[model samples]
Target: MAGKGVFEEIIDGDVYKYYADGEWKKSASGKSVPIINPTTRKTQYKVQACTQEEVNKVMEAAKAAQKSWARTPLWKRAELLHKAAAILKDHRASIAECLVKEIAKPAKDAVTEVVRSGDLVSYTAEEGVRILGEGKFLVSDSFPGNERTKYCLSSKIPLGVVLAIPPFNYPVNLAVSKIAPALIAGNSLVLKPPTQGAVSALHMIYCFHLAGFPKGLISCVTGKGSEIGDFLTMHPGVNCISFTGGDTGIAISKKAGMIPLQMELGGKDACIVLEDADLDLTAANIVKGGFSYSGQRCTAVKVVLVMESVADALVDKVKAKVAKLTVGSPEEDCDITPVVTESSANFIEGLVMDAKEKGATFCQEYRREGNLIWPLLLDHVRPDMRIAWEEPFGPVLPVMRINSVEEGIHHCNASNFGLQGCVFTRDINKALMISDAMETGTVQINSAPARGPDHFPFQGLKDSGIGSQGITNSINMMTKIKSTVINLPSPSYTMG
Candidate 1:
């Protein structure tokens, strides 16, 4: 069992080397990137930032590991994944603490991320067997003459070395989500976690090492995306790239050339409230989806579209609920915490101020203390407003009034992003109608648009992203389908 002390050591700042070939090593260039604790706005540690040359070395190691990993028995790989999950379970508390210290994640949310990540590991281990590419018989049914003459075989083939890049918002969960499936699909992984959330990820790498994976099977490269992002993604060794970030995912996809790219990008998710919505329930759900984690999640509710008949009432409930949310240090168990960086805080503030200057009314007073911003609800916000379209990624919810459900759907669809959205109503028919019409990937009838179980298809439509992320989907994404056809001698029938 991994001890609490093991997890604590991850945050102590002494272990700053990048993990490669089952060992930690400093960058050959001897350069490092400073990691800041979001809660205090202070530099907590510096991690080795692998240079392009170091990336080349890591890719070579990963490529060599990929061949054997792909040949390993499925059950054997699954067993190791389950073992990693057990290690994570033992150090759950310590892992959550690291997240709080590293990214200023609210304690409860941080723990949930860690536990869910472990769940993802377990879920992938089990589901990988079921989803593993199996030989499928292909028959020539349409051509009766060739019925028994042709048959096709299909199998899921591993895509060699995978370069997985995770976002800052979900350092552990999303990072592990990528690693578990990549490994289960028999692909070696080279993970690049952003500096904002490197500690939790490095700790996760530690857990992976404890799981007894072979050397060169997994590596962690920490650094600024600009410095080594292209160097890693465009390398010839990487067969596929699984990325979750905003504009960076797009940039990588273009440079990745013909390689398979699975990306889950940004979102401007909205929550629509019809005239018949239950105000109390809707308000609570809205606050949870919008403000939790300081609105850092890709699926967080960035805008609210409500019917004019019930807009004012819902806004009141939202204001009351937002007012009660405590904004403090991550350790304080606040309902809200600091954004990842000062620039993020400033961006949110600037959006709110821009909305106000354009006549958007604030429902409650907002407080900006350094990197943290208390919840702010804006009323009378127009769809044309930047807040309505941009991904603020802060604790700000913009409420826009709509005349009808059609108008609401139209407004939601007009945005460049189509990640996730939800509609609140009791009418089953109406719910189905809105859900089908909405352009986002997933729609919630009476709930917020958030990623749920590890088995469900968690993906974004349109500009939100190109590929999906779930146990089954990720396995398919990480593996390639190969079909083989063998022509057999045609059977001859003798007349008796």
Candidate 2:
């Protein structure tokens, strides 16, 4: 409340009275990290850097609240989600501001995120009713002389506590991706948002309380990833952990011990341009899909394989479009923005430099103003180059020329990441061929990878992630099935 916006509220038990639990307070650490504007590198506000113990308290409250919250009616639980969505929509302005300040995301992108966040909540609420179980049934019909046959229905139940770990990029939507489904499923949540972008999710939690949710039902702890992550994943009380970060996601999964897990790791997604494709349309879509979020999305296109005939033509068109994109402050409307961190900016610079040394020439040398790195293009990239194999997650696109569609498909599948990919071709057979050969979980034909409307089963194939998370998919990952049968002391079926 003291940092930026209005001091609103915090709630306790299924009510609207926000009781300040001291242990859940922001860090007492005097030193703070800068939350920068990627476009201008301007300091927004330095959030309180949380210690390990403070992060644990949120999960502790979750453990305390899980049993009682789980027993609440499914429909009633869903109502809280609906309420949260409504409140978030009403407070979109302030929340969007927080998002822009924290991560330097474009104003338009932030607004869309808030709306999509609400949609996620609504979707989860709808999916809640569908979790209903079937009635009991037995084998009485099969045996004419049998007097008894009963089998209890198999329906979903809460997985106690859910520790949701969201990334810095798209902080609001990614966090809600976990929160919505978990809350709708009647499970208490302990949200550990990125330390760099903690305010957005904090504002979201405040909105949740406004929607009449019990205080302990949803909680937050802002802190360093390594410390909070270790605590959350290894905690005995947490039944499952939902993670969305690159290396951090993997770390959480490994430390989950025996707990159920859901992960959405970053990717070096690819896009293929074929001979018969329209180069102009392909260029526009490529720019928007790849660098829309500074290439920070896990599904962002980092690799492009073009057919020999159209490689030069398509590259020129994409270069012209990339050059025209306006790079400015996230507060202002702009086609592109700066990379998220100074470290990230530096890394991209090094990657480009290294590639250039290895004969991969950039059409334009990357320009860096503080943390914001403008879009840079490089052609004649080989698979052996580090930039070709690794994920830049920045505004850098590297093109690799391939002779045939078959070779392009082979190169795309060679990477460890299997999150997303795209192909553009007039021939249905070629599209189908790449679709079958690509190792990724989600592949688009003439379209970029996306997770919109909150309905698809979004997951990865290999190292990208282990489990999936969406409206209904998130529910299924955290739950297991058990059979119940009542056969009137069924001695007839037993060999004994």
lDDT of each: 0.86, 0.76
Residue 449 displacement in candidate 1 (angstroms): 0.8
Q: What is the Cα-based TM-score of model 1?
A: 0.96
Best by lDDT: 1
My TM-score estimates for the predictions, one after another, are: 0.96, 0.90
- List residue ranges in candidate 1 displaced over 4 A: 1-4, 7-15, 141-145, 492-496
lDDT of 2 by residue, 168-209 (tens): 897889888888888777788887778666767777777776
lDDT of 2 at 404: 88
Model 1: per-residue Cα lDDT at residue 75: 94
Separately for all candidates shown, the number of backbone clashes (residues 3 or more apart, or on different chains) is 0, 4
